[model samples]
Target: MALEINMNNFKEEVLEAKETVLADFWAPWCGPCRMQGPVLEKFAEANPDVKVVKINVDDNQELAMQFKIMSIPSMIVFKNGEAVNCAVGLQSKAALEELVK
Candidate 1:
């Protein structure tokens, strides 16, 4: 399962992670967000070396606003404390793997 991230713990878990971090910004009411959940879970399970996180927009509104998340199911890939890439829609596991590489 992907780690649940929030505004209170964002700095500790994501911003400070040493490994590559992939964050999926989602909301419970979003259909696309629901579809992306299992993908992220599977991806996280397969890629143990990388950090996969899930941030619920409804719960973590502050963090969502900080990242300018205007849509659900947005993914932000971070490395060395900086956001290197972002995908703002439903994406295949292969595409996500490519981003990790």
Candidate 2:
């Protein structure tokens, strides 16, 4: 399961993680975000080496602003606390997996 990340624990969980971190920025009302949820879940199950977390833009505006997330269903792959790859809107399992790779 993807961890539900909030402003309070974003630094500790994402910034300080030893492994590659995948952050999915989304909101409850966004249709694309909802659609991406299952893909993320399966990705988390398959990749034990990666840290997957979900950030709700409505609640964590500061983090969203810092990441420059102007769109919903944004997926970012982070290595060494820096964003290496990013994609906006809905993505298939293959595409999301490839983004991390």
Candidate 3:
């Protein structure tokens, strides 16, 4: 399972993380978010070095606004505390893997 991230732990777990962090912005009510979860789980299992974090947009509105998230299932790949890549909407595991690279 992806690490559940929020305002409290966002800095400690994501911003300061040594490994590349993949932050999935989602909400419980979102269908696309549901679809994206399993894909992330598989990816996380395969790639142990990469950190995967799930942020509930409803609970973390400030984070969503900070990242300019306009949709659920949006993914932001953070490298060295910076957002190097981003994908919005539902994406295949293969595509998401490629996005991490």
| Candidate with the greatest lDDT versus the true structure | 3
TM-score of 1: 0.94
Q: What is the C-alpha lDDT of each candidate?
A: 0.89, 0.92, 0.95
Give the 10-residue window scoring lowest on summed lDDT in candidate 3: 91-100
Residue ranges of candidate 1 with Cα displaced over 4 Å: none
Model 1 Cα lDDT, one tens digit per residue, 52-80: 99999999888889899998789999898
Q: Per-residue CA lDDT of candidate 2, range 1-101, in tens?
A: 88999988988899888999999999999998998999888888888898999999999999999999999999999888889999999988788889999
**Model 3 per-residue lDDT tens digits across residues 21-54:** 9999999999989988999999999999999999
Instruction: Give per-residue lDDT, candidate 1, residue 89.
Output: 90
Note the residue pairs that clash in candidate 2. Answer: none
Looking at candidate 1, the ten consecutive residues that score lowest on lDDT are 6-15
> How does each model score on TM-score?
0.94, 0.96, 0.98
Q: Give the Cα error of residue 53 in candidate 2, in Å.
A: 0.2
What is candidate 3's local distance difference test score? 0.95
